[model samples]
Target: MNDRPYHHGDLRRAVLTAALDVIAADGPSGLSLRDLARRAGVSHAAPAHHFKDRTGLLTAIAAEGFGLLAATVNEATDLKDAGVRYVRFAREHPAHFQVMFAPGLLRTDDLELTTARALATDALRTAVAEVRPAEQGDDARLAGVAAWSLAHGFATLLQSHNLDGAVGGRDPEEVFRTLSGLLFRQG
Candidate 1:
């Protein structure tokens, strides 16, 4: 429908959904405000109003990603479950996963993004606490870092399809569970 009639109804959501579709199809580098507007059936300036610039849009996606991640991580029964969920989240939301890690593309100072990131971090740290005994200072921080690094690295590789054939036809989370077991299980 060329010359589409537009209304302000859910325009912001439409733009964000269009942005996700664009990111899913063409990667973040290919994202354009004009294209988002076209996809959302809004004026070019509409997207700009919602997200001041490209970085703002990316920041929105990153913030959304972290919020989703925090919710997923919180669903875990333990650290191993959290790791598995993390990988699954990456697999399911590839676009979000990609944008969430690329700091250079997003507005790092965005309050929503920072807050959502903190939520995700808190979720991860909660899982880490289950993985390691109660400890003070850097010890707990170190454990959380190590746990996050391992799970994140695995999720990244899984998202890139680096572990495609390794797991055969089995569920990816199952493999993640097995891998997580290696670290979660202590001697």
Candidate 2:
């Protein structure tokens, strides 16, 4: 047990950081509010004050993850850039990425989570619109889905080390750029 002070001005942030560390190390299933409180050097019940329960904590993580993802991808200049950024976000925030997509573990109706999800979806749609205009209607939606699937699948594979043989020595972003180029022809 760390000897951190019992009082914290930002207990929520402290608890969230501890939760992320736990998730990254042992996966979400191994997480416990008690463990988070210990990691944060607070009382056993301290985490509950902010998170209420495990689901609430997971919801917060999902919301934060979506917000971060939206900001990351929103900076892209094009669809390919957005895809690459998405993959990078997964790599950089593996704990958040893992929780963000697990609908069963989160409060699907959480206002913050829903709003953040919308922001991320909108960011992806904006990127898709740059290539496939909205005038194409369903085609644009389909393209967005395809792009998201490709990026998400690639990120999952990369994190699982399943791409070691296929990617060889190449950087992931460069490989993603090449892969996206081959799959998506700019019109």
Candidate 3:
């Protein structure tokens, strides 16, 4: 056996990127650290250097997903637009979305995961702040929940092919515009 030390430079990122690709193609259930290391062209134990175990790798993936979602949501021009962006991100990053909300798979206490989740939540809170009317207290919170629910439901429906026949011929952006407009109609 070759005696060269298997020091994979930037192994953490390499493993994570490889893991994302694997999750995208085969779902989270199919992920394996040894497989990830192989894909990264590193030794089987290389991934473990960065991620202690499979759970650590999964937590990192969830963290990355939330970070991307936060950035996308924060870039929206308006609160209503941010809701649309949320749905767009989910549709565009189905693998990430699939991993982000998969309970019992990620370590909830992991610092990276917690930080990323906070950033995403903060982005949503900012969006809510923009649209909340004065004198609306609990109602504002409810509105935020409604916005999230609508976006998540729409994304899930799109992913599951439930809307394929229903949304035929209509541009996705146009559909989002109409749906967001209806949801955010001024009362």
Candidate 4:
């Protein structure tokens, strides 16, 4: 019940990082602001300054996750490579991805979340541009959705162990590349 305010300059980031770890280890149901404070080594009420409630904390984590995802996906040299990168990001940052798309858990209206989502979407759009260089407007949008679906589905399947038996003895990355190739029309 320590009532001292946290003077740490980056309390918000600390709380969000802790929350992500907790969610990763125990899922969303195990997250608590007080528990985060304990893990963060801050006073119980310190988290309130950064996140008013559990939802606020979740929103922050989702926002950070999206930003990281965008950065990771955008680093690929080509659109097809970006799809592979997206799957890698999901696998490498399982905790972040878990919170990023867990519906109703994050505050979608929060400014940080909105901006992060937009950045992530822009990364997807860039990948689409690489695929459909000449197509503009609606066609590009459609292509983006299709590409995202392909990558997301593959990542989700891998994450959930849905493809374990199907791809026996094959590296997950190799499986992802093979599956992605089937879904994507290569030029």
Candidate 5:
């Protein structure tokens, strides 16, 4: 049990941290608000006070993940950089990544979730546009979708250890770069 003191919004942070830990270890299906409250060293009802229920908690995680993804990819210098950033975000935040895309587990209409998703989408679109100045409209949109699919598919495979033997000790990010280069041969 945590012996740390709780102040103001500390409980919310604690609960969120605990939830992430649980999700990291056991995936989203294993998350329980009661278990989170116990892990956070607070009353069982404490988490409910902040998140209302399991879906609400997952919604919060999804929103936070999208926001983090947007910020991460927004730092990219090019399309490959953006794809690398997306893969890195998934690798670094597997729990969040797993939860963020599971539409069935989230509050689809949640304002924060919708807003964060938009931010990530816009960032990816901007990255695609910046990379292909002549390719606008549907071409740019398709490029963004293709880039996203490649990065997302690679990240998911990497996370599941499907690339362990195939990568042959190469850094996953580097492997992603190689793969992205093959798929998106610029000029």
Candidate 6:
């Protein structure tokens, strides 16, 4: 007999939000469906109904992360803006960052994940092109790689606390702007 309160008005969303909170504090490894249920005040089996398994829950999280990234980048004013926003997103959603990029943590082949990732990729590539405008595919592709690597690396380092002193206490966005400008040799 499932004796939990099961008071969630929208169990799926409540569970997902609770999962994000859990992930933020404990990382993905610390998450459990039962714990999520408890946090959501739902029956333990309620989460299972929404997510067949842990992988299913993680897959949904990853998909949402990519969509969030896409929206964040697409709203930026320029390549530098996009880079700054990427870092900001990472900082704001550390749990999503942790689960989204870690391939082994989620079902990468899930259709929802693939579609969301494609959208994020397209948005990122467009921003990268703005970094170094070019007509040739190779140049643009390489520039995109460079831009993505810069932002991803910066964000990853910051998220992991490896860059506490790398930027000398300046805001992360400023540090990224400076590094990106120097790397791309842009004004």
Per-model RMSD to reference = 2.1, 2.0, 2.1, 2.0, 2.7, 1.7
Off by more than 4 A, model 2: 1-6
Residue 119 local lDDT, model 4: 95
Task: Give the runs in model 6 whose Cα sits over 4 Å from its true position.
Answer: 4-7, 132-134
Better of 3 and 5 by TM-score: 5
In model 4, which regions exceed 4 Å deviation? 3-9, 134-136
Off by over 4 Å in 1: 1-6
Query: Clashes per prediction?
Result: 0, 0, 0, 0, 0, 0
- Model 5 residue 11 CA deviation in Å: 1.0
Cand. 3 Cα-lDDT: 0.83
Which pairs of residues collide in model 6? none
Per-residue lDDT over 1-187 for candidate 5, one digit per residue giving the tens place of the 0 to 100 score: 4454544458887888888999999999999997887777776777888899999999999999999999999999888899999999999999999999999999999999999999999889888886665346778778878989999999999998898999878889999998999988654
Model 2: per-residue lDDT, tens digit, 1-187? Answer: 5456579889999989888988988999999998888877788877888889999999999999999999999999989999999999999999999999999999999999999999999999999998899999999999988999999999999988999999999999999999999988766
| Strongest candidate by lDDT | 2
Computed on alpha carbons, the lDDT of every model, listed in order, comes to 0.86, 0.93, 0.83, 0.83, 0.89, 0.88
Over all chains combined, what TM-score does candidate 1 have?
Answer: 0.93
Instruction: Give all TM-scores, in the order shown.
Output: 0.93, 0.95, 0.90, 0.90, 0.92, 0.93
Predict model 6's lDDT versus the native: 0.88
- Residue 55's lDDT within candidate 2 is 99
Error of 5 at 144 (Å): 1.1
For 1-187, candidate 6 gives per-residue lDDT tens digits of 6675656679989889989998998899998998888778777788998888888998999999999999999999888889999999999999999999989988899999999999999999888766666686798889888888999999999988999977776898998898888877543
Clashing pairs in 5: none
In terms of lDDT, model 5 sits at 0.89
**Tens digits of per-residue lDDT for model 4 on 77-147?**
87778888898888888888888997599788899999989999998888778777635788778888888
lDDT per residue, candidate 1, 1-187, as tens digits?
Answer: 3466567688878888888888887899999988888877777777778789899999999999999999999999888889888988988898999999999998899999999999999999888887575576688789888888988898888777787889778888888888878877742
Local distance difference test, candidate 2: 0.93
Q: After superposition, how far is residue 150 of candidate 3 from its true place, in Å?
A: 0.5
